[model samples]
Target: MTDVLLGIDQNVDRAVTQAETMLDLFDATDLDANLLHDFVDNPEGASVKQVDSVKRARDILEDAGAAVTLREGSGDPAQSILDMAEQLDVDLICIAGRKRSPAGKALFGSVSQSVILNAERPVLTCGSPGDEA
Candidate 1:
């Protein structure tokens, strides 16, 4: 069985697209997906399961017959995702990449870029719908 750590953010469309991509790439029966959401500024202590994007991704993966596990993290999203990937020892880490200008990325940084550069394992990234190559 191949284990996958899928980082889910606030974009429901991206999350669904990522889920569909995973289903297309691998057989559901052979995949174990860990759906993760990070609450970067949650003074209210939000749960990952409570997030709409995470829930939608979980539903899509689960409906496709993939074994799904919900995970929550607090603080930096990139670090949280990386830590979770290590903790779970997943075969691959999947994340949706946003279309950002170089200046924008430089100013704000990118979680997907950080994960890709620093990960000890393979990372799969897909551009958001309408993103140019």
Candidate 2:
């Protein structure tokens, strides 16, 4: 019974796309909580968006026969992802990557980069469709 932590941000469509490509990796999944962490200051709006995002991912994964339980968290995206993965002790971490220019990444550090650098477990990253990798 492998536990997979599917890390997602506000890009619900991109997350769905990544899930479609990686769900087969986890043999047996009974997601206790579909963790949705908001990395924004405004709690109210962020919570609403987080719920919607989690529900979308939940629906997509559930349709594919994955049992999902929705959960919520707060703070930095990368930190939240790492914290959840560690607390849950997940077997694998799947995260969706957005194509950002080097300048942009320098200006605003990459979340995936942070997780990949700091995570103790394996991190699988999927870029958006048509992305140059």
Candidate 3:
């Protein structure tokens, strides 16, 4: 099975939805998918809502036949994503990218941009309508 890794950010549900949609689109083909939801889950600094959401995302992905795993990082979402891709030796990666303004890009380096620039495999990016900047 060709492994497709969905690199989920702090907001994981959206990534899962997009990846599933892609899977459904290619339903006729043979492909295997999994989701890796990463975050900084410091025992003293994490929010209950965040933890629960990540867990729920994992459960949903697993139910959909993709292995789901939650990994802890030091708040570097991009690094966490790359680490997971390397560990899995994934053939493809799907990540959520919001439309960013020039200002936004200057202020906060775009994670999607970083991934697209660094990924060894193909990276699929989805953006919100308003985020189309």
Residue 120 C-alpha lDDT in model 2: 100
lDDT per residue as tens, model 3, 43-127: 5766423654456555655665664445555566777777778888988777888766889999988878888898888888864
Error of 1 at 112 (Å): 0.8
Candidate 1 similarity to native, TM-score? 0.95
Clashes of each: 0, 1, 1
The candidate scoring highest on lDDT is: 1
Per-residue lDDT for 5-30 in model 1, tens only?
99999988889988999999999999
Model 1, 72: alpha-carbon shift in Å? Answer: 0.7
Lowest lDDT 10-residue stretch of candidate 1? 124-133
- In the range 91-120, model 2's lDDT, one tens digit per residue, is 778788888899989999888899899999
TM-scores, each model vs. reference: 0.95, 0.82, 0.71
Q: How accurate is candidate 2 locally (lDDT)?
A: 0.70
Best by TM-score: 1
Give the runs in model 2 whose Cα sits over 4 Å from its true position: 28-33, 45-50, 131-133
Where model 3 places Cα greater than 4 Å from the true spot, the runs are 25-32, 40-53, 128-133
